[model samples]
Target chain A: MELSGIAAYLVSFFTFVGIYAILALGLNMQWGFTGQFNIGVAGFFAVGAYTSAILTVPESPWHVGGFGHPFLVGIAGAMVASALLGLLIGWITARLRTDYLAIATIGIAETLRLIIANESWLTNGVRGMSGIDRPFAGVFQTLGLTSAMGTLIVVTTFLVAVYFLVERARQSPWGRVLRAIRENEPAAEAAGKDIGRFRLQAFVAGSAIMGLGGALYAHYFGFLSPEAFMPLYGTFLVWVMLIAGGSGNNKGALLGAVVIWSIWSGSEFFMSAALPDAWSGQSGPLRVILIGVLLQVILISRPQGLLPERAPKTVPFGKVANRKERA
Target chain B: MDLLIDLIQLSIYGIVLGSILTLGAIGVSMIFGILRFAHFAHGDLMTIGAYVGLSFLVFTGAPVWWALPAGMVGAALTALLVDQAVYKHIRRTQPVILLISSFGMALVLRSVVQLVWGPNVYSYTGGIQRPWWFGDIAIVPNHVWILLAAVLIVAALHLFLTRTRMGKAMRAMSDNMDLALVTGIPAERVILITWILGGMLAAGAGVLLGMDSRLTPTMGWNILLPVFAAAILGGIGRPYGAIAGGMIIGLAMEISTLYLEPSYKPAVAFVIMVAVLIVRPQGIFKGTL
Candidate 1:
């Protein structure tokens, strides 16, 4: 590939990075902030994608002529639907032990995939739905910009906004409570926190963000399939990103998404390009092996990840007063 | 009369399936009981065991009976090696870390198997002639053998657990690891023994399952969920509870298929597990880690 082609590939890669970053931020809030291990993120993502696709697909019983609604509205719908589903699932499984919770969430994710696969009317079944409209296509056409460029622009903007919001949330009192819950659920409970409610709140809110990311992904890809939302893809990648990047830090999440996604895409590209024809068929299995080895290395070497969460520095009241007086 | 026979036949199949599940679940439950965490790799371990049996069958060209013992021995050794290599180092880490490590191990095992065996289904038994039966229903010889094996395994396990010194030590360690260690029960040896036994049983189950149906790389993936469900339903650490739970889950799953789509069979066990967890979080057997 030429330099421009490589650059274009980079653009597509970073677009995925931005989208997954948003999703990982949500997961960080749930797992890192609130200590709720949700393995069913792909389910919520699928729900969001299917919701937006079904609502906006032309000639559907659920709605008419795609409603010609703005892409932003579809994103909003995805978030809302995902949040509702999250609330239901979180309420049911939140109180279970960590391992059981993981199992339950995995089950829910698999079940969601199965439903999407079997329900032909809603998701077009295994055939999948296509022809999703890209946002700002008209503006891009007028500017003579490529659709990928337009998508990159919109997705980056959304990601930035999401990052800002998550950062603000991290600094807020609500964020403190979530951290408290993560650190010691019993302590939080003794401190008059409604553990279940707070967990549900965090889970639902984070899942909504994941849903929004899914909606963005659907529009960019112009297609939605049950296969696109496999548990391995959704759960494992999110985990890799969160763990590889510092879990609690939004910046780490973003960096992790970009870095890990690049490794993944680059490896696949190199394997296909460099390997002999006979060995080419083995690439997929090789990729899985690579990821497994990488995960083991990460787990053994740095459980806290590359850019681990930093403890907040405590400032003395006397120092604050002295500084204020000087100012 | 015909309906009664069909029900009996269904129950028999369910019991056989339950036996396989019980064996697998016991391995998982024992690991969880001693290790204080769920090992997601147990299902894949079952797959490993099945593959071991298949390899034995192919290499020695042994009868199915001879292959069974060889497979069990292979499985026991593999479990010991896996423990020494991957699990022993990280056993002291946080439960979640160990759990995640198990996932990595599962992936490695599954991938290695796929690379070696390819993704296609393999038959462990070269076609057995079906035994002719009385009445409207004809019971396959393999099914009867599976059920008999399950009963014998369970009986042997019960006696071994109750009668043997090593088995007593395992129980003591499971009940209280630190206490068992302090009492000079050699907790490490006990754990090794547990893994060996668990591995043997899991391998036996896998071989039986392969005999009943085709063995594929993903064979264990489908069974993993139900086995976990059975383990949880039976109570995490209790062997007898796992057996009972397996039977219930197997019956529920198979019988439910009569009413619902076959694809939904896996979900039945999951639903039952969740419901049991919600109702009695400690599981039906009332043990806690």
Candidate 2:
């Protein structure tokens, strides 16, 4: 490939990686930190994308997109919308087991997808929203770099900020409480922790981040559709990222995001190159199977993940001393 | 009288749908009750079964009823293989991890189906047969076959569980694994039997439902929530509860169309499932949590 071609690929790859990184981070916070299994990641992501798209896009006759606001404002609106949805779902389903949450979230996500598809007045039904504004299109054109590269840089920088923010939260006392509840819910309850409240907080916060990822995605692509936020795209893809990278570790989440996404997007290229024309249609299923097998292998072999959650370095002095005595 | 006829027609349709749900739900509930975790791949297993039946119809030119048993066998073998290859190894992990693993299995199964079936919608037979009139209500042959198959399977399962030695042993293990083990009930044998029964029933449901509607790779996945709802609504681990839950969900979904858009039929089932989960997590029939 030529240098320009290479740059294009890299930029597109990094942009997708950044988008998924944010999403995986959100999920890591929920399932990793708080032990909340949110199977409805797609729902929050869709809410974020559509909310922003509807808020910022110019008015259309068929749909509700008259706000025509600034890009950042739309992004904020997406986050708020997703956060509110998360809060409602979390509050309603907080007391149940992870199994219950899994079903509820899937139901919510699928229902949302249906609504977006059927409720044409709001979402334009199947056609989806277009002409979503990117944040720095003018700057990219001025620099003579492809617009994709500009979005890539912006999205990557945003991803780094999100990573740092999540990392900071992980080290906080609230984070410790979340870990405590995850390790042992009964014990956490006994220690006077309001388990439900903490779970709700994590769920909402995680959902907000996922929504932000959706906004970035919509702005970058300049289009929004319910089909883009299918469970396969939104939920399973992120789950694979977290599980492979090592849940509960922000850096691992990032690494997994880049590696797995490359494999996923890269597989199609490899398959098309390797296979004959007649067999090319089988490539999608082949790649899906590859990922599924990878997931099973990961779960069976390294349930803790590639980079397992790090053991805390600083221990309670008393406990350390007692352990030394025993040794 | 005209309204009554419409109501009767709807009820028949509901029952037909309910029987399919019940068969699928029974498999799911049994897996949870016996094996102690939700089987996410159950829906796809149903799809696999339906596809296997379709294959029989295509290649052998077998009658639709003849395809049912062959499909059930294929699905059963797939379940056994899947259990040996996947679920057996991860049996010791956290239930949540097992759940995730099942999701992977679902992916694998779905992709395999897509690969083999090429993602096209196919019918068992191309032509639509006219429905027979019962007084003023119309009943299709496919619906009758579905209802008949479901009743036969359920009755057979009931007799097997109540009368057969191995079935009773399976029940003992489900009731209390530790005590059953102490009493020398072979755990492996029971587990095998559970998978076979679950597989057979799921396949039966799949084929019959496929007969009623066009078969697609996602037919089972589409109805996944309703099946799960039926299982949970009836009581997750109770076979009879699944049957009752299926009937209720099928009726509710159909009846909901009176007040809701037909497109939102599945949503009605979901709403019912969530409501039941909130009001009674153990299920309406007091299932074990």
Candidate 3:
């Protein structure tokens, strides 16, 4: 279309990239650092989006929003709700085996979707909630900030803040405990660590971050729909991101999200543009095939991902012994 | 009296559904018992079996009874091929890696089904008329057949496990692979046989499920949660326990619809599964995991 139109699309794409990066980082913390194979990130994401939308949407019956408060307050509320839900689910399922944990998470995610789809009173059912006012609309209008620029500023600021927080958490003693639990749960337990509690903490913290991403997404779009939280879109894509990224590394998570999402978005564009008339109608199935193929190829070629986690270096025991002997 | 009748009707439907679940659970339990990893692709295998049955019915214009065997055979062959191609290759890998691979396989199989079936629902029997009777306690003829087939399959499985040489080898492998190999049981051959048996059971379950409900590309996907729930609830590695667990879950899901919304049936299973994991992680039946 026009130059401005293309620029607008690019801006929106970057905003999405930032939001997904946040989601990937949160998932990386849970699965990579904590060794909790949670396949349910989408459920918490839906909870966050729906929570913010239900609260802030105009003329809703379920506890009116803080008088159409700013987006930050809604985001904070979504994070708290998501974190509490994560805590509850994690407490129950964290102690189970990895496969059981995966199943439980999947079940919870699906059930959450069902509730959102069917609970008409709270979420407006399948009709979803709309008319959510964007943050700083008046300011943007007065200050001459475009919609694209406004979204970019808000999303980028949040992304940078979350990145720093995740980095700090990874360097802290808590992060060490989480890593220890991941590497050897029994040993960590023997070292007087409550494995379940640490895992639950990581899970909740990560889920809260994911919830923050969801709230940002809702506000950016100015609408909320249960369809947006379908398991395939939300859960599978997050798993793909975590797996494609070196799971334990924050940088890897960011890179993977940007790369995979670009591929996904690019494929949609390419398929719709290039397919012959006869086969163009089947582009949806073709897109799914492409994703499935990519997942298999990635898993087989480098299960540890492109930038696998590096082992921490330690002084050799023999060298240490020799030095002590010489001294 | 009305409540009693409703309960009985629900129980009957539960038993029919439970029978299909039992068959699928048997395969899953055996795979876990022998392979020592949860095979997530088993659900897709059921879908594959249903599709195979549909193909047979369409091509051969065969009776549903004949199509059932064709489906079972097709499924057994597919399982054997999958085992040779994927599972055997990853047999030496870490259990977690194998688990992840199974998830990949599940995705691939589901995609293939979607590609072939075009995301539409299919039925092999073409909506057979139910023979209703007994004053609001109606019974479908297909349901009776499914129940009968389930009993026969269980009986046959029990006999095979108890009385046959391959069955003994299967048990021996499940118990200790190294010991079985040392005893000259041909571990690879026995494992192949176990997969074949598991595939047959899965196919049987798939066809029966298709008879009960329409076979959408997502039919197996929908039942996967319950199947896993049954397997975990019964004890992951115990075939008999899986059977009982399937029955319990089936009954629980059906009965819950009486008090709760029908959409919440799977959630009820999930809650029970989580409760089971917390309260008795080892499951009600004892199996060597």
Candidate 4:
């Protein structure tokens, strides 16, 4: 392959890494800071992807696209859509136990997949909606940047912007409220923090960020399909990335995305190459098993990922922890 | 008259589905009671049981009914191994962490099913059975077995919970963990039994489900939400209430087909679940949580 080809590949790799990093950051907000479990990351991801795809794609006879709008419009729409979903989930589950949130998230994600698959007028059913274009592809030509590099640059910009915003939130009093709630909901409530409201806000904000990641993926990938947002790729992998990279640490979230995605992609490449054609289908599940076991190992040995969260100084409770690390 | 017939037929189907869901809901409720977390991997355990039963049939040429015990045992072992290997270590931490681990375990179990079973749909029997009918309503032979097994297992569970000392311990643990521990119940032994019972019930649900329909890698996962809905409706940690929840949810899901497309059954479940969460988070029964 030419040097340009290698450059394009690396750019594409970084582009994906950046997109997933944004998602991990969003999850960090909900799970890491607030301790609100959301297993339905894929639901929000799909909503964002489809919302963006429908807004930006050319109108079609089959599905609910063909608006042919700008990429940024799609991205905004994606975030809004996902935020709405988050708001609903947060409003409902915020008042309930964390487990209800988890169950409800799974339910909502499954329902979304069903709608995307069954509602032909909305998502073209199973055939899928395609023809999504990158953000300002033609304008990047003047910059002497290939479409891949342009995507990489745009994704990086989003990642950095999100990182700053998330980091800023962490340092803010609002972030402190969230951390307080996660550490001890009863204490936070006693301290006059509206646990429900803060939780709803964090959940919605995190969901919006996930939606942004989904929109970026849509614009760069230029296609929309249900298969693209399986829980394995959309939800589980993001959770793994967040936890492994060290939950609550934005930098760790980013690092985990780059590291885990590389391993995931690399393993896929090897499995495809090494396995005979007859056993091709088995590799996917084998990889899943491997990842599952890896999560178990991480939980047992290193519950705090590679980058342990630099938790702000706060009082801790022993309700859920026997080994509390005071920061 | 036709409408009435349709309702009756649908109700019959609902009862069959309800019976199967009850088996799963029982495990979920009991696990929640004893373990203090929603077992997300439960559906996958069902899948594991279904495939294990399939293996029994293929390897030993046993009757389909025999696969029931074989699958229950297989699922029981799987659950035990998972708990011992992963969940036990995390028990000292938060139950929420266990929940996350269970989610991962769900995926792992599903993938393992896919690997061992080759991702192809399987059936206990290829030959179609004639429906046992009365008037306009028809009951499939397989459904009879499902209902029978469900009733028997539930009865046995009722007895175990009330009569046996171990069963009392299990219930005691669910009723009040701290008090039960203070009363000198061996928490570890209770936890072990809980996994075995939960695993067996989950497998029973899975095998019966396969008997009713076709067995696929995702068979258990597909119904997990509905099962959750049932468990929630009955109250999270109340086993007997789960039975009532299962019956109601199963009936509602099937009867809704009268006005909805079959594909929308899951959405119906979701709607009911959300409604319950909004209106009465404690569920129909007083939830231990």
Top TM-score prediction, candidate number: 4
Instruction: Provide DockQ values for all models, in the order shown.
Output: 0.54, 0.71, 0.50, 0.79
lDDT score at residue B10, model 1, on the 0-100 scale: 73
**Runs with alpha carbons beyond 4 Å of true place in candidate 3:** A61-67, A311-327, B84-87, B176-187, B287-289
Clashing pairs in 3: none
Candidate 3 displacement at residue A290 in angstroms: 2.2
* Native contact fraction, candidates in order: 0.41, 0.67, 0.44, 0.86
lDDT per residue (tens digit) for residues B63-108 in model 4:
8898899999999999999999999999999999999899999999
RMSD of candidates 1 onward, in order: 3.0, 3.4, 3.7, 4.6
Off by over 4 Å in 1: A60-69, A313-327, B1-6, B126-134
Q: Whole-model lDDT, candidate 1?
A: 0.81
B9-58, model 3: which lDDT tens digit per residue? 88988889888888988899899888888777788888888888888889
- Model 4 in CAPRI terms: which quality? medium
Backbone clash total, candidate 2: 0
DockQ of 1: 0.54
lDDT of 3 by residue, A211-316 (tens): 9888888888887777898666787677777778778888888888888889888998899889988677667667766776666667667777767875445568
Chain B TM (all candidates): 0.95, 0.96, 0.96, 0.98
Most lDDT-accurate candidate = 4
- Residues A177-212, candidate 4, lDDT per residue (tens digit)? 998999988999999988899999999999999999
